[model samples]
Target: MNIISENKSKKIEIEENKSKILDIKKEIEEKKIKIEDKKKELSKVKDMAKGEKEKMEEYKELKKQFKKIENEIYSTIAPLKREMRKLEKIVTDKKLKKQIQEYIEFPVKTFLNDSDLNVFRESIPNIEKIEKNPRKREKILRLIEYVLDGNLEDKKKEYMAYKEKVDSFVITSREENKEGIIKRKIDNLQSEIIKSEEKIKNLETKNDLLQKEILKSEEDIIEILEKDLDVKVQE
Candidate 1:
């Protein structure tokens, strides 16, 4: 009787549900407000994230150039893999076979690390013994001899040239990015953005269910009051 507003009750059957306050109607409204506020916060965070990424333009460009130079180095050393694969199968020496395998696996790194083609020089005699597929063996041996003769030394020099670019890019990137402070900030913001977006999606999903449940609750209350009490209910 105290909750009655004329003929209407001001309070419902329950003030809360479960361990947490679950005022259904109020919860839906509060979540709607939070969704909007979060959207605005996300927009600002996105803008800040954009600004942080812009600051790393130099580093990004360096990365682009680094990939380009790496591809060039890869292209330069690519043929060695095919030559080594055939020769590795034909060569009998265990040590030389492994050395050939290294070049096949990390062609560019192995080539650059060889130093004046000493790896090829050491393996030359072993490779010379390869005579299984006479034609194929001749071809593979030709490649090893080419490296020993310093004809392929230019490729190593070429790799070193790209290495210089990488070294310079690293030094400049560290100095400009200032130990990656901007990159770290950008990464953190990206992580926050993902979390915030997920939170908004979850809240929206909950709000949708809450809104429907509230409507259904209202319908059930009206039906019960009208059928059981034999009275019209209006609020």
Candidate 2:
């Protein structure tokens, strides 16, 4: 009876060990599947990072291309725009009939050549801001008109004043030139007078010497006459 009982116990112990081994195998299989799933997720993340890097590179290339295009546009168009603005001014100025006629020969060129387009574009924001507020727009327009009128009037006055100043300067310059010539003539005349005075002094000194020589000759003649008269009396 004791031997049979020990055999039965060994069989139950062996079954229990087999069951624990099967459980361990199942657990290891589940852990392996989880590890594989984590590897797949890591692969997807790596692919996503690569895709993002490619997208950024593409974006940088596109930005460089766009900047290059913008630079080309500016370089090509700036001078053309400046010409257009000058033509526009010529057309607006009433005195430029010849210029207007010349510009009419190339209307398309004139229109495209206006560099003021950039300035107009920049003003759009200010225009929109003003338009959004009616009171502000009216006030701004009124102020602009007032300033323009004031400036126009002031410009006329300033031009007249400038003309006067220029005329005055011209007159003053002419007067100064005349004064300079007159002074030069007076200096020449004064020099001539000094030369004449020097000549007169020279002549006076020569006349005094001549008069002294003549007086000495006359005295010598009188002494000779006296000696001759004395000799005649002794004879």
Best by lDDT: 1
Task: Give a tens-digit lDDT track for model 2, residues 1-235.
Answer: 3434544554555555555555545555555565556556556555655665565565556555544544443443343333334344433345343433333454333323433333233223344343457776565445334433443344334434544555554555466454345455545545554554555556455545545554554555556657667988999
Query: What does candidate 1's lDDT look like per residue over 1-235, in tens digits?
Result: 2213312431142212221235434554665566566566656666766765664565576566656755765665565576567567776779778777888888767776776554566545655454456787676667667657776566556656656766776676566555356456556655665665666567567656655655565665566555545543432
Q: Pairs clashing in candidate 1?
A: none
For every candidate in turn, the CA RMSD to the true structure comes to: 12.7, 60.7
Off by over 4 Å in 2: 1-146, 149-159, 168-180
| Model 1 accuracy (lDDT, Cα) | 0.59
